[model samples]
Target: MELEFAQQFVRPILDKISSTPSSSELIIQDFAVIMIVASIMALISYKLKQPMIMAFIIAGMIIGPNTPPFSLITHVEILHVFAEIGIILLLFVIGMEFPIEKLKNVGKKATFIAVAEASGTFMAGFAVTQAMGFTFFDSLFVSLAISVTSTVIIMKVLEELGMIKDEATYLIVGIAVIEDIIIISLLAVLQSVASTGDLTINEVGMSIILVIAFIVGVIVLGSKIVPRCVDLVGKTNHSELLIIAVLGVAFGLSFIAFKLDISVATGAFFAGVLVAESKMRIATKIIATPIRDMFGALFFISVGALMDIKQLPLFIIPAVILIIVSFSAKFITVWAASRAQRLGKTTSLKTGIGLSSSGGELALVAAKGGADVGATSSFVLPMVGAMTIISTFISPYLIKYGWKLASRLESKGTGSSDTK
Candidate 1:
């Protein structure tokens, strides 16, 4: 009945739109409506004790093409491209926000910790996928998808809570960088195999080497070249010109990576990191901030829009089990890593919690990549969405507990000294 009705009703409208070239203006109209709604919802959400990002997502879900009442949004090819632009800008800002000196100070220990925690988690997740009868490629995507955490959401939550400059924040930031590097590297390999088809699993090593080489190339060239370009553009004293330059570097590099089967976010991130050490980076980030916020909100909305709600409940049991397993897995590993690095017990615990909560971007990347490779079904989406929801709710409490533990430990140490 649904199929017959869809063919008669929905299919005709879709066919009419496709057959009509003059419907181009309708695309712009749809974009405007979604953006306006997203902005208002974000602002209202702030007044309600929630982050603006959450509101943007909920707004998207409500007005999405799948919904009934708000039939405003249309699924368009242009929206997808714009959404891609949003993600690139978002990642570029993430790179700009990274402190190079802090990373250097944390050094090898943080590197080891990030690698160990991520690797162990991935292995565990991969094992689960295999036992559930998944193929090698599917297991690979599932492992990578489930294991990596969202750095953006966690850091934002920490900052909103005034925990940004604390010990826990430091550990979380450092570990997230580690995880991002690992997951991105793996993605580069996955993309190469998927695109080439005949590339086979054995060629994974070469692809990884190429990815590493590209990263090193970005570091060497981006630092020297990107900042100078920004500086030159700034001297023109034209704000539009400056915006154009930043967007050029971000999008140009992203396009280059896309042509090579590399992810746009990966390219944008490196583009950010390369210029991180530059003096003009602050100015660049300031100019790019509004642009990032505007389009980045769209990216999140696209995520919510893409969610397959019908399968959500079916994926619930597996999602719960995976979230529990993955969260537990990362918690101990990161907690231990932070402690070994002398972040202390409380900070370590909070850092672990911060790293565990993820949503939106990285999971979407993994699931998209999985489906692209024919490694998984649409089920990955619901599983990821559910995990994201649970983590979002749980992280703050874990952070609160971590702070309490730190205080109690500090008090005990002080009392012992007094007794002495």
Candidate 2:
């Protein structure tokens, strides 16, 4: 029903772009449309106190080929390239912020929590999707998508609520870092599996070995080399040159990863890690942030653009079910893990709520990977996009109310102890 409406609505717009003589003009017009629409949506999102990333996505859905009315984007292929760059930069910045020292300091408790929560959520997601009658590969992709929380969203909400300095914040961030690492590694392995189109133990084992080797080789060698090169660039006192040099390394490593059939996200992340070891980490991050933001928006916009709104009604029920199951599983696993670490009940509850949001860049990346491989169901990407937007929308409220709930529970416990 929606498809018929979209087809009729999109025909004239497609014809107009097709008739346009100059390719460059079409590109310019597309950029203008994207920026103007995205800015407007972002402003509305701001007014509504929603995540800006969600705004960018909604903007894409509005202007993209999948929706009704003005389907403004003509050159989706170009946008896709930009989106890939966005993912690279997004992961790179995340990697830069996570230095080896910080990971080492994340502690056993945080490590345990991260692993436990990720494993539990992944299992739960798989089971739920399988029960929903999804294929094995679709279930695998969906499970992977929901296993990790959005570190960016969590931190942003924490800062907004003035809880960035809270004790639980540390553990939450630590667990997020570990989850990022694990997810990226899984992406690399998944890429390998996709490339070979074989699920045999030999192939799987080889893929894991290759991923480990690539990571160890880059870290062990790049740490010694990237820092000294960065220091030298810093001494030049040329910001432009510093930026170019860092991007060169990022793209350079990413290219190598691509050639090796690994996910470029893995390479870009480790590249940032290597750069972080340098004295110029702060300067590089400052230089790289705007670039990351721009490309990151493009990446998310592309994700939204790929969403088939016409098919959304078909997947809406599954998306809602997955959201509820995934969020509950994550919250329970995180809370239990925190409690096991001897974190107080209030802190544990806060940590659990803080990490409960199930969608982010990584989830979208995983969905995209599944789509690219053609190994998952057609509904996976759009379904994940829907889930992401909904979860991001509700996460802040959950955190805010979760604080009051935790406080009440603590009061009840105190009263019971007093009575005792």
TM-score leader: 2
Please give, for residues 20-41, the per-residue lDDT of candidate 1 as tens digits: 5456677877888888888788
Instruction: Tell me how far candidate 2 lies from the true structure as C-alpha RMSD in angstroms.
Output: 7.7
Q: Residue-wise lDDT of candidate 2 within 316-341, one digit each (tens)?
A: 99999999998899999998998888
Question: What's the true lDDT of residue 167 in model 1?
Answer: 63
Judged by whole-model lDDT over C-alpha atoms, candidate 2 comes out at 0.88
**Candidate 2 lDDT trough over 10 residues, lowest sum:** 411-420
Backbone clashes, each candidate: 0, 0
